[model samples]
Target: MVTIQLITVKVTAEPSDAVTEGDTVTLTCSVSDVTESMRLVWINSDGKTVVEKTLKEEKQEQGLLQLIIQNADRDRRNWTCVLFHQNIPKVLIPYYLKINMRARILPDIWIITVSSYLFVKLGFAVGLICCLKRMDRISNNRNPPKATGNKETVQLQTLNSDADLRSSNK
Candidate 1:
């Protein structure tokens, strides 16, 4: 008769599950049970092994593997923690990372804020111009323009015209 022992492998992210872009992220893999032939490996989304460790190297009863990523990005979002016993894969734990990029959203808000401010200023200038025009119109209606004339100059012109007409008739 033979009995089998179960092992639990877990992966966790340091700082938080979600991080902002350009932040440093750390992924830790821990196993509940450690054996002499047990190996822990960290794999990327592309099925490439990043780091590997064995219980002999750690000299501990529990297995732990850590991978650090500087400047987290979309390319480093997915990872896998694989535990192997005697060169055979036993457990696989996958972790997904969330990165927030504020650069994509802030510009839209800034453009809208600037546009609204300019619109308000333009509206105020237009209203001021309209009010000034209205006031000028009211003032003009109250005081009409007066015509300017020289009385002597008008009389002389009329006399000359009359003389010229009489001479032509004679």
Candidate 2:
């Protein structure tokens, strides 16, 4: 005669705690009665299987699940630990993952851009002023007062002759 035993599988675990990025966590799942034949399944929020094992594989039905989040900007995911035996579901535990982006720097490139622009504007203004001064000097040399036949030119010549006479007398 063959006999079948009714087994009660009760899985218990420590309450989940908050963890930072790149943290190592140890999750323990224990089944009552059939501790030696229990199987454990770990599933993420998206219903994706992460790990599955039987009690024969490791003692304490424990697993070391490390959270290696490559993209910190992504949303947190839900993790579940399911315990079963003989293809029958026994217990379920849910854990939440919290992820955050570590801000490293603030942009100060605007300050540099504004300063460079102002420097260029000031340099252009100074260059324009210098160019105008040089142009004024060139125009003055190119078009000097003409010696027109007028009273002003006559007075200028009389003064020049008077200076010449005085220099000879001296």
Candidate 3:
């Protein structure tokens, strides 16, 4: 009587599932058992084989394979680990890589934003000054200054008051 053993395949990412830009990531594919006819394969999201390893008859223990990615970016996000027996797929494991990108502000764009803000403020100030000037003109036109007699007549009235004060003192 022959008994068949069930095989299990698993894929794991080293460091963590989330990483920053330009980081290195390692993917490990482990099988519960290794056989002479078993093959381990790593493929990308596009179904392209990245790496493959075939178990030799000499090693009958568990199978382990690793794929290293250097400078990981958003483009290298999806991957799959597959196990094959006699060129037929037996197991498949999928992995997704999350990359955190830093926000960047361009120098030219920053300058333009600041310039636009200052320009708007200046325009508002100029408009306010012009409005105030116009209101002042309108107010002056509505209420003209009261005229206090002519200069020469005011001087003559002051002289007469001085002469009357001297006579009253006498």
Best by TM-score: 3
For each of the candidates, the C-alpha root-mean-square deviation to the true structure, in angstroms, is 7.4, 10.8, 10.5
Model 3 TM-score is 0.60
Where does candidate 1 stray beyond 4 Å? 1-4, 57-60, 104-170
Error of 2 at 114 (Å): 9.6
Q: Which digits, one per residue and each the tens of the lDDT, describe model 2 over residues 106-165?
A: 445777778899999999999999999999999999999787779987976777789776
lDDT of 1 by residue, 101-152 (tens): 7476788989999999999999999999999999999999999985459788
Candidate 3's displacement at residue 28, Å, is: 0.5
lDDT of 3 at 86: 91
**Candidate 3 residues 49-112, lDDT tens each?**
9999988656787888999999988888899999888999988989998888845658778999
Better of 2 and 3 by lDDT: 3
TM-score of each: 0.57, 0.41, 0.60
The CA lDDT of each predicted structure is 0.86, 0.61, 0.87
User: 8, model 1: CA deviation in Å?
Assistant: 1.4
